[model samples]
Target: MALCEAEKTFVLHGVEENFRIDGREREDYRPMELETNIVSHAFGSARLRLANTDVLVAVKIEVDVPYPERPREGKLEFFVDCSANATPDFEGRGGEDLAVEISNSLAGAYRSPEVFDLTKLCILKGRKCWKIFVDILLLECGGNLYDAVSIAVKAALWDTRIPLVKSVTVDGNNIDMEVSEELHDCQKLDVTGAPIMVTVCKIGEQCIVDPSAAEELCSVGALVISVSRNKFSTILQTGSGSLHPQTLLECLQTGHKVAQRLHDALIETLVDIKPSENSVGFLR
Candidate 1:
């Protein structure tokens, strides 16, 4: 629906020369900005903008009974909402499809316990545990939605602080717990193995990572690859176009390589982020 045969051929030739229309390498990700603790109401929060695509992630913590199956583990849930500001079509339910897609992708990425440790969030064996609610808001959609959302979610989880438990008491059928009242009495979430998703769009005959809006429109097909600590977690086919077996394999390998680089760069940038520095949301 987006491209003519001539345009597709033009994009293919560009990829063959290792020179994309946007002048980025086949493995290069777009520029991104990240900020933590933006929403005052949430326990932890972060906002990420990848070129024109903007995503916000907020973490909310609540006390709840441990699940019967996992009495010692916490719960992690994802909710995604598309904002009207992204496009006029997204004014209401127009963006529901996109929101569902993003949320499902995120859920799949975090499904593995090895990627995120929920045991640490447990308060008592069967009594109280912390449930983390990660709400994602799509403010814009330039391109590469999965990558931007994963990065933001990881950053927000890192910034999240769980309140320190001061005391816990369990009655025969009831439980009571007292948490630290001090605002600063909190613990940071250990997010060392969080995964990052990298999308590679195949245009004409070549594949490129982090496609621009125009590039996305021009691509015949795309693959979404999720990586955690250099390991593959999930791979999804997005666009309607199909790929040959050999090309699909090559694309998966390229995705792993690019995803690792992106993850490493993100860690470095996050560690380097200073609390004292000013972060301009969209203006910059």
Candidate 2:
């Protein structure tokens, strides 16, 4: 939905007045609903709806040989699929570029060991390891896809459980392993250090977090900031517009602060979610 000139002016004025059309102040996020462990066959899964944008994330694990150069570390890959029903623009192959961009950004954010320690997934150095696949499905795109995707990914990772290896036997270059049969004999992933991304849009000389589709069209430029454990993991500039150095600094400050608060709130919410709880459908 493209905004008309008058509609764009309205949004601009609203931002200049320090209030958005949705009545949210700068740096405030839209209402979000999160649910975890919603997929039965997946190792873990989560769904998040921020205002109108909806995202579902599932985590799957497989045993494979570790890369020779990084034998001590396991593999973590991200895949994003934008449903054509989400928007008309996503029809056919229209969303492929956006999906690739999002997947790449997520991969880069988790590349640092301090953000997500892949070594913890190693079953046997250079021999076998658990390769995690995080698959994201975008059901809708109201706005703020980056923030919503990151939060859902973190929650899904938190809910993931890895099967315990009971025993391993090696004979003449052949290796065999036994996994625990007990359903409860699994290890939960530690996602405390997982990065949270925040998108700050520079609108009318002020920066805002979690912009709606309409607001996004009104923005000149935006910054996507990924914060992990009180530190920045990746900062990427988006949009064709450029910002002055001072404004860029201010945007960073806003993104960092908003990301921290968002992360804390997300962690608290995940802790309270029960494994057997029913999913709150995406209608909201």
Candidate 3:
């Protein structure tokens, strides 16, 4: 409803002129701020804000027996909860539908063994394994929810530290594992292969990255694509509209390029993070 036929034409003209309705280039990403270790109760935590959309992620670990088939592999799960702060309608179960949809999409993205190595999380075969619970909280909804959540989740995972197991002993159905008491004795998750989602908003004939809520409402539809390094992880279509094949492919191309840049930027930021520094979550 935001874009009538005449207004759509104006938007198309802007895209053609290399200036979008929001006065941004076609490939420009919205400003993002990331903070880690905001939650003391969780093993790892991160909060990210992209323009207006904000999300928080926390990782928790639990002990449980390994599955019979994959005794050596541990468990990793994803859960998302939408907070009322995001929207008044999301006061209780109002946001559950959207939360489930986002969680399911993320789970599908990480389902493949190649995406995340759960096997490395196993401490003892058929006896003990670490179960990781990733909880995502949606704090605000401006636009580009998928991208913000993905970035926050990845940063949280990067900040996660797993305790080191000194030794594992099993004798006559009794198993004892020795864990390091030193707080410094921990290992970080290898998140190099983690994928990032990039959303491409399709207008008349062009695609824009990180569209704002107003601009988003003006779009006909959008595509959500997750990419890791140079590989395509997952591609999903959202919005109540259809895309042509060629346009879809073009949107994917845009998504890939944006995703690559996003991934690289995250890695650089994480690598440059000083261990002794403190995070400023939502204070700034």
Candidate 4:
């Protein structure tokens, strides 16, 4: 939605005064609702609703050969799909560009071994490995898509369970493996190090987290910061606007601070979630 000159001015003034249109402070985020294990067929699944934006993520695992150069590490891939119902711009293939951009950002954020350790997924050296596919579906877009998607992906991965491998035997050139048949025999992924992304928008000399769609239209530029283990995993500048050196530094500082808080809250929420709890579907 395009905002007129007056609406843009109103948003700018709100940022300057640290009072947003939605009654949130500059560093404050909108209300969020997160649910896990929503997709029964997936190994893991999570859905997050941040204000008006909604994102659903699912994790699927498959046994495959590891990369030649990284035999000890498994593969992690991200795929994003923007539903046409989200926005008119997302109709048909129009959302492909945005989907690619989001998927690439996620891939980059998880590339560092410190952020997401893939070695735990390896079943055998230079042979069998678990390939994890993270599929993200954008149900709605109000703003701050990167942050919402990252949080949802982390929650889904945390809920993921990998089947237990009972035994692996090698004879001549043949290799055989046995997996535990019990549904209870599974290994849960450690997602404590997974990165949390924070989007900081620069508007009228002020940097704000969780910008609304109207506020985004009034911003100069934005910074997407991915934080892992209290450290920056990736920082990407978005929008065509340019920022001064000092402003850039300040933006980074704000992003880092907000990301840490967000991560802590997410972890606490995930811990409190019960596997048998009912899921709050899209109707909510």
lDDT of 3 by residue, 1-284 (tens): 24576776777788778798777798987678888988999989999988778899999998889889899899888999998989786887899988898988888888777778888899987789999999999999888899999989899999999989999888989888888889889999878888799999987677898877766777788999988758888888989999998999999999998888888888888887787764533212
lDDT tens per residue, model 1, 135-214: 99999988888888898999899888999999988788877789999999989888879988888888766788888877
lDDT of 1 at 205: 66
Tens digit of lDDT per residue, candidate 2, span 1-284?
Answer: 99899999999999989889999888778788888888989999999989999999999999999999999999999999999999999999999999999999999999999999999989888999999999999999999999999999999999999999998888868989999999899999889999999999988878898999999999999999999998999988989999889989998999999888988888877776665773443212
lDDT per prediction?
0.84, 0.91, 0.85, 0.91
lDDT for 206 in candidate 3 is 78
Judge candidate 2 at residue 100 and give its lDDT: 98
* lDDT of model 2, residue 182: 93
Model 2 TM-score, 2 decimals: 0.97
Of the two candidates 1 and 2, the one with more favorable TM-score, higher being better, is 2
For each candidate in turn, the TM-score is 0.92, 0.97, 0.92, 0.97
Model 3 vs. true fold: TM: 0.92
Instruction: Estimate the Cα RMSD of every predicted model relative to the unseen true structure.
Output: 2.5, 1.9, 2.8, 2.1
Give the residue spans of candidate 4 off by over 4 A: 278-284
What's the true lDDT of residue 239 in model 4? 95
Give the 10-residue window scoring lowest on summed lDDT in candidate 1: 275-284
State the lDDT at 164 in candidate 4.
98
Q: How many backbone clashes can be found in candidate 3? A: 0
Model 2 Cα displacement at 172 (Å)? Answer: 2.1
